[model samples]
Structures are given as C-alpha cells and as structure tokens.
Target: MTSKIKGLKHIIYDLSRINEWWLISAGFVLFAFLPYTFMHHGRVLDIEMFRILFTDPAVYIALLIVFSAQIFLFASNDYFDRDVDALDPGKRVRNPVCDGRVTLAGVRALLIVTAIIPLIASLYFGLLAFLFSALAMFIFYYYTAPPLRFKNKVFLDVLSHGLFVNTFPYFFCLVALMDFTVGTVFLLFAIMMRSTMAQMLQEIRDYHIDSQVEKNTVVVLGQKRAIWVVFSVYIVLFTVTTCLMLSYELFGWGIPMYYSIILILAISYIPIFRKLLKAKDYNREIERLWMGQGRTNRWQVAQYFASFSIYFILVIFLIITGYS
Candidate 1:
C-alpha cells in the first residue's frame, strides 16, 4: 500500500505543470470547438445549445487525448533532461525524477499509459484525427527521447517542437470539427510560427545551463542570435495572424464583429515588440524576463492573458449571447 501510494503521488506530482499544460488544454478546446461554434453559430439560439457543447462526449475525449499528450511532453522531457534539469534550481525541484519522487521505470510506465489513452480516445474522432494524434504522440515521445531526439538537434529542435507542441494539437482538433481547407492550412502556419518562437524563447531562457549540455538550436546560434530568431518568428506570426484576420473579415469567414478586438490586443504588444527588437542590452532584458521577480513576470502574464483571453471570453460570450 505504501509503495503504491508513493507511485501514485509521483505520477500526479509530475503532471502538476498546470501553469503550462492548462494553457495547452485551453488551446485544444478553442481550436477544436471554436470552428464548430462559428459554423453553427445560428444554433446558439438557446442556452442549452451552449450547454450541449460542454456536455458533448467529444469534448471529454479530446480533453483526454490532450491531457495524455501533456503528460507525455512533461514526463519525457523530465526523464531525458534529468541531468540538465538538475543544473537549474527551479527545474530541479519541480522534476519528479530528479527529486527522487519518481523512478526511471516508473516514468517509462507512465509514458506508456499516457500514450495508450490518447491512442484510444483519438480513434473515436476519425482515422485522420487518429493519425494526427499518433504523429503528435510520436513527436512528443521522440522530442526528448534518445536517438531521434528532436529537442537536441539544430533547427529540427524548434521545428519538431513547433509541430507537436502547438500545430499538431490545433490541427488534430481541426480535423474533428471542419473539413481541412486552405484557410485551415494558413491557420496551421501561424500556429507553427508561434510555437517555434515559444520553443526558441524557452531555449533562450535556459541558455545559461543548456549551453553546458544541451546543444539545441539556441545553444548553437548563441543566445543573442536566438533572441533575434524569436523576434523574427514573432514578426512572421504576427503578420500571418493579421492576414488571417483580414481574410476572415473580407471573405465572410463567420468571425464575429468583436474579432477586431483580438487584432487590437495583438497591437498592444508593440511595447514588448520594441523592447525585444530595439533593446540596447539583450542580456539584461532576457535576465529580467526569466530570472527577475518584478515587472518581467507580470509582463509575461499579461501577454499570456492577452493572447488567450479572446478565445476564453468569446466562448462565454457565444454561450450567453446565443441568438436565443
């Protein structure tokens, strides 16, 4: 009983990356279901329609698959990066394997179980979604695993992270809700660009220690150039998203009138835009972003909320303002 209790504790403990995994969960819900709401917007005539969205069996299945993906992402990363993680006080304390809260074989078993759940849940969607989930599972598994470890490779590091971390999940959800089209492809491109920026920024944040052992893309390019890469990717993402919004508006893609609010919010990031692109001292700015406990952290939180709140608030608004 005691051993089993400890095992359960470690499994639950390692999955406690709520600040992160929850964001991915939100992304899954928005990307998977938003198109459904838009296409069937007229169905919002009743509060029960909105309630049905939450109560639908598919939502639970997608949540199961996404949560499994997150478990694989964090656990595999921690299992493989245990040595590198031990170098950072923050990561070291949070890592179950490094902290001796989870065993190597136990993590392996956990990974197996997590993968199985996604495989089972995705089949309910369709063959295409199942395939998407499979590829996502493969990417998440091999991302930090040996031999084909995409996380340690130059360029491929960010590319693979871009695919599975964000693009794949969104695409997987897209497969379930809508017929794949050119518009969906464009959206995938925007997501991939944003994911690349995020992965590189994380690498930049860990440059101090990652440089020692993890020869990732950022380590190869060096932190200065890596930040530039992040900035450049952000520009591409911003441009693509702007174009997407424009297309939706012009082509009558069924987006709401308030969608312009999202563009305005994106514009609001101009201050950080100048901070990253026009900063006189990159080192100090990066340090404050990752290490400082002041405005930097608050800035990140603001960015997070700004980027995501539109989808979140829209979900509620759609539910309430249903043509009902």
Candidate 2:
C-alpha cells in the first residue's frame, strides 16, 4: 500500500510539471477575466458585473474548455518533445519527464483525458467554439508531428507557437461572447505579434540546443540576427497596437483606459529591449547574461499579472460607462 501511494504521488507530480497545470490555470484566468475586466473597467470586485461574469453558464463552460485544451496541449508537447527536452541544457534540471519521473505513456493518457473534456465542451458551445478548439488541437499535433512538424521550421515555428498558444485562446474567449468584430480580430493579431516576438526571444535563449536539433527560428536566422528580429518585431507590435488603441479611444469605440494598459505593457518591455541592445555576443555565456533567466521568469509573471489587471480594470470602466 505504501509503495502504491508513493507511485501515485509521483504520478501527480509528473502530471503537474508535464502539463504545466499552474500556467494553464493562469491562462484560463486571463481568458475568463479579459472580457469581464473590460466590461467592468478597473472595478472587478463590483457586485453587479461580478455576478454576471460568474453566473453566465456559457462563459464559465467556455473557460473550462479553454483551460482543458491548454492542459492537453502542454502535456502532448512534453510527451512528444521528451527527447529534445532531455537535450535542453537549461531545462533538463527542471523537467519532470526528462528526469524519468513520468513515463511517456502516462503523459499520453493525461493528454487524451484532457483533450476529451475540451472536445465535449466545445461540441456544446457552438460551431465557433468547436472550430477554434479543434484548430487548437490540430495546431498542437502538427507542431510536434512529423511531415509537417511546423515547430522545426524556423519562422513558421515561432509563428505557429504564437498563433496557437496565445492568440487562439484569446480568440476562443471572444468567440464565446459572440464578439467577432474586426476590432477584436485586430486585437488578436496584435496579441499574436507580441507572443511571436516573445517566443523568438525565448528561441534566442535556447539557441544552442536549437542549433543542435536544427529546429527553430534562431537556428535558421542565426542568433545575432534573430535577436535583432525579435527587437524589431516588438517595436512594430507596440507601435501598431498603440495606434489601434488610440484610434479606438478617439472614435469612442473603446474606453481610454485601454491606452493606459498598453502604455504599461510598453514600459514592461523596456528592460528586455535594453538587454538586447547591450548584449555583446550570442554564445552561451552571453545568452545567459541577456536571457537573464531569473529576470525572464519575473517578467513573464509580471506580464501575466498585468494582463489580468488590465482586463479587470477595463471591465470596471466598461460597467461604469454603461458599455456592459
């Protein structure tokens, strides 16, 4: 019995790390709160909007599906990339599966279970939700699958990750609300751009392993050029997104508070931009310096927090302005 219990505990730990359950949970919260926050503005704790946000069955169900989809995708990635992950110098120590604590079969089983839940939810949600969910799964599969394994295709690899991982979830949320406006699409595009650039930066960090595997944008573009490309992409995304928000605010299409939120995000990128500019080389040591692994982790945490906070604030504003 004790042996069985130990096995169970190990399974749970493996699941937690492989599926990155915490990160998926964070993504779900971010998705659930984006519309709620925008509708309520900054006052997330308000009773009226809060009640509406929580009580809506469709919204809640959609969020659950999104969360499940993300979990499934994460697990599937770990299962497929176990070998590559074992080769990753920076991630080996932290990877649960790489350490052999979790069998690939266990991860595959978890993926199936996670995938089923979202699939059922999507079927009930409507065609748009179902379509996006299916697309998300397809993207994940193709990202790791052979023949068209886009994850190993340089620029397309980063693009696929950004679109499927970040923008798709955001789109799922909007689709749930039945808000398929051009503005929403443009917003998703901006998100895709930002996410792609961020992934590119991560590729720069993983340049060595990527080169070994011959599987990423940084490997194909070369480290120096890839870093510059990431910087350029960030600048363009920031500029375009800012202009769009300003136009929306000026035309009375969106609340001015979104502008403030965008400004905050822009400020958040300052350190990353500075590091890119000052970094002297693209080798391991230089990569370590610019990657600022600790700083990157902190920045990511901050970005997630900012994303939720901005959405919450926007929702409150929307409620006050009677947009809700």
Candidate 3:
C-alpha cells in the first residue's frame, strides 16, 4: 500500500507538470469557444446558448486536441533545446528536460501518446477542422524538430509561432461556424500580430543562449533592431484592432472600447519606454528584461490581463445590447 501510494503520488506530480495549472483549459474556453460564440452574436444570450456551447462533446474533444498539441510542442521544444536551456540560468528550474527530470525517452513517449486523440477528434470534427488540426500538428513538429527547427530561423520563427499557436487552432474552432466575415479576418490578423510580439519578447529573453547556440532569431540582428520591431508590431496590432472594431459598427461603444484598451496598454508600456530611453547600453537593458524584476515582464503580463478583459467585456456588451 505504501509503495502504491508513492507511485500514485509520483503520477499525480508528473501530471501537474503537463496540466500547467489548467491554463490550457481556460485558453481553449476563452480562445476557441469565444470566437465560435461570436457566430451567435445577435441571438438571445441565455442559459440554453451557454449550454449549447459548454455541453457539446465536440467542444470538449476539440479542447482536448488543442491542449494535446500545445503539450506536445512544449515537450518537444524542451527536448530539443535541453542543452541550451541547461546553459540558460533563468530557465533551469522551469525546464524539466534541462534538469534531467524528464528524459528524452519520456519526452518521445509523451509526444506519441498525445498525438493520438487529436487525430481522432479531427476526424470527428469534419474535413476542415481535420485539415487545420493536421497543419497545426505539422507546424508544431517542425517548429522544434531537428533539420527544420523553425524556431531557429529568423522571420520564420515568429511566423510559425503565430500561425501554429494562435491562428490555426483559432481557425479550427471558428471553421465549423463557416461565418467568415471581414471582422473575423481582421481579428485573426490582430491575434497573429499579438502572438508574434509575445514570441519576440521571449526570443529577447533567450538571446544570449540562442546566440551561443547559433540560432538566428530576430534578436540576433541586434537589441536596438529587435526593440524597434517590437514597437512596430504593437503599432500594427493596434491598427488591426481598430479596423476590427470599426467593422462591428458600434462607434458609440467601440470607439471608447478601442481607446480604453489602447490606454491600458500604453500605461503598461510606459515603464518599458522609460527603461529604453534611459538605457545607453543595449545589452544592459536586455539583461534587465531577462534577469531583473524589470518593467517589461510586468507590462507584458498586464497587457495579457488587459487584453483578455477587454475582449471579454466586448463580448458581454454585444450580448447585452445586440442580442435578441
């Protein structure tokens, strides 16, 4: 009984690592289902509609598939970059592969096991979902796998991260609705830009290790260039969001909504802007971002919270004002 209890405890601990506090649970709900819910925008917001969205077995299956893909990609990335991660002082505790907690064999087993259910779910969801799922899987694999580790490439890295992690799965969820609108396209582009910016920030944090490893990320171009690119990406993302809001034709609510969201982002970004302006040594600023309790991380997290809240509020407003 004692040995069995220990074994069970170990299993539970391992599962926790894979679960990631069930953020995937929240992500699939907010990201996958929320966009799908947009299809029912003009419909009455009530318990029945909520039930239809939440209670569907297909929805759960799709969530499982997307979650599996995310885990597989992360595990594979850890497996492939274990050496670099081992050298990265910042990532040691969080990286099981680098610390020898999760072996290559274990990672491979994880990858194989998680790939099965998504395929089954894809078949059930229909051809379009299946195709999107398959494409996402391909990108996820190539993003970290040898010979084609797209993450090591310059522009390709950000593009792959944006599409595989954000766009494709989003489309997989939204495809079933088949309600493609100009607004949908704009929103998708906005999401891609957002994802790219976040990915770029990560690349900045990993710059030294990546440089040692000969990985050619955008940061390799130099700190000043990378910083400028980050600024540019955010500007484009803001523009896209503005365009999306205009498409909704809710100037009264949408205009305020746009300025509010932008203001939140700007407030968060101010600290980083201060740091940048005062930072004479580019490397020092990068180190502060990566190693110190700098404003960049705080701002990034704030932006994440603000973005989710703004979108959630927008959905609620639409339901309250426009729903029949």
Candidate 4:
C-alpha cells in the first residue's frame, strides 16, 4: 500500500508540472468559471444552490466533466508542444514532457483517461451538457493537434478559443442549472471579450518562440502591431463590459465591479509598458512580465488579476446575500 501511494504521489506531481497550472489559472479557470458558476444559480446567491453544488453527486459529476475536459486539453497540448518546448531555451522548457520527466505515452494515457471522465459525466448530465462538452473537446483537440492545428493559425486560433475555452464552459454551467435565457447571450459575449484579451496577450508573450516555430498569430502582424492588438482588444473589452454593467443595473454593484475590472487591466499592463519603453530587449522583458515564471512575473500576475478577483468576489458576495 505504501508503494502504491508513493507511485500515485509521483504521478500526481508529474501531472501537476505538465498541466501548465499558471496558464490554466490565467486562461479561463479563474475569471470565467467562477462567475458562470455563480450566475447559474439565478445570477444571485442561493444557499440551496450552494449546498446542492457541494453535496450533490450530479454537481460533482458536472465539475468533474469540466475539470477532465481541461486536463485533456492541456495534456494533449503538452504532448504536441513537447518538441517546441524542448526548443525553447527559456524556463518554458521546464515542461515535464520536454524535460523527459514524463513520457509521451504517459501523457497520451493521461489524456485518454481524462477524456473518458467527461464522456461519462456528460452522459449523466443530459444532451445539452453532452453537446457542450463534446464541442469543446473537439475544438480543443483540433486547436493543438492535427493537419488543422488551429493554434498554429492566426484568426481561427483565437476565435476557436473564444468559443470553446470561454463560451462553452459557461454554457455548460447554465445547462446544469437549466437557466438558458436571452440575458445569457450578453454574458457570453462579455466573457468572450475577456477571453480574447487573455488569448491575445498569451500569443503576444509567446511571440519569439512561436514565431520561430512558424506558428501564426497576431504576432505575424509584428511586435508593435501585436501590442496594438492587445491594447485595442482591451479597450473594446473595457467598453463592452462598461456597457454591460450599465445595461444590468443589479442593485448598483454592476457598475463598480466592471470599472474595477478595467482598472485592474490598466494597472497590470502599464508597468510592463513602462519597462518596455526603457528596456534594451523590449520583447524579452515583455515575455518575462507576461508569462510570470520569472522574478517579476508575480507582480504582473497579481496586478493583472487584482481587480478581476475583487470583482469576482463581489459578485459572489452579492449572490450569497441575495442582492440583485
């Protein structure tokens, strides 16, 4: 039993390293999932819903489905990117798959195991949940794998992510709650805008390695152009969320929460820009700041998520208190 436990611990450690936990946190895990989970419970807090989420087997199953989907997606990407990861001289090469800490076959097995969980969970959740999971899985697979690797493509890469990564998860939660309505459309678009910002920033940060690997992104538009892309996307996102907050005057919290999100975005990137302006190697500095594995990454990451996290917490509080 002790040997079994040790083996399992080793396996979990390996998975954690390869999972790219930082990317998951920055990508869709934090901002998108939390808000949507709360929104599903009538866009306000309900103790019963919270209880159900914790104590109910179905809720656990749904959560497992989403978690497994993310694992499968990341694991597959790890497998596919191992070569490029090996090529990357930066700390990005710490990837278990690239560093020989885990084998390709091991990752493949992990992906297959995780893939099954979502399928089983989907069966339990009903057709809508099943459809959302399936579509997300398909897009995620094609996003990194294949003759049609969307991640290597420009517009399709970000657009597919906007749909699968950001939108599908929210829809899955809505299905679990059985609360599909017109207002949800606005919420979906709002989430899409935020997701796009994350995706564009990621692409921009990875410009050097990705360009060497011949992966096309807005980076193909060049560094200055890519920076502009990020800035413009944020502006549009800020504008849209402001409009959304105003449109949904939910007891006066919406405006402040959205403004807080904008503030966080501004705070997070401004320092990076200021540094970039004075840096000898602007791209390298930007990459370090954005990726957050280096010495200064934490400051950037904390600033980036500060206002967003607060907004999320505020929403959760409002929901729990039954505030509109």
C-alpha local distance difference test of each model:
0.72, 0.67, 0.63, 0.64
Please give each candidate's TM-score.
0.81, 0.80, 0.78, 0.76
User: Against the true structure, whose lDDT is highest?
Assistant: 1
**lDDT agreement of model 2 with the native:** 0.67
Ranking by lDDT: 1, 2, 4, 3
lDDT at 201, model 1: 73
TM-score: the better of candidates 1 and 4 = 1
Per-residue error for 161 in candidate 3, Å, reads 1.0
Candidate 2 error regions (>4 Å): 1-46, 249-255, 281-296, 299-324
Decreasing TM-score order of the candidates: 1, 2, 3, 4
lDDT of 2 by residue, 1-324 (tens): 986676556555544442434455555446545555555556454567666666767766776776777666666666667777788665765555677766677777777787788778987768877777888888877787677878789778897988877566667777666765555566667678776876787677777777787677788888788878878877887777677667766786642454345457766777757866677654443345334452244455666587668777885777678752
| lDDT tens digits, residue span 90-184, model 3 | 67656676766656676777778766767777887788877777778888788878899898888899888876664555566666546465545
lDDT per residue as tens, model 4, 1-324: 987675454345555443445354334333333455566677544676566446656555655666677777767777777777776766445566777656677777788888778877887868777777777788877888878889889888888877676555555666665654444555566567667766776776667777887666666786667666666766776676666566557554344443345545654566766675456554566667665663346665677568568768875776567654
How high is the lDDT of residue 323 in model 3?
40
Task: State the weakest 10-residue window (summed lDDT) of model 2.
Answer: 286-295
CA error at residue 159 for candidate 1, angstroms = 0.6
TM-score, model 2 to reference: 0.80
Worst 10 residues of 3 by lDDT: 251-260
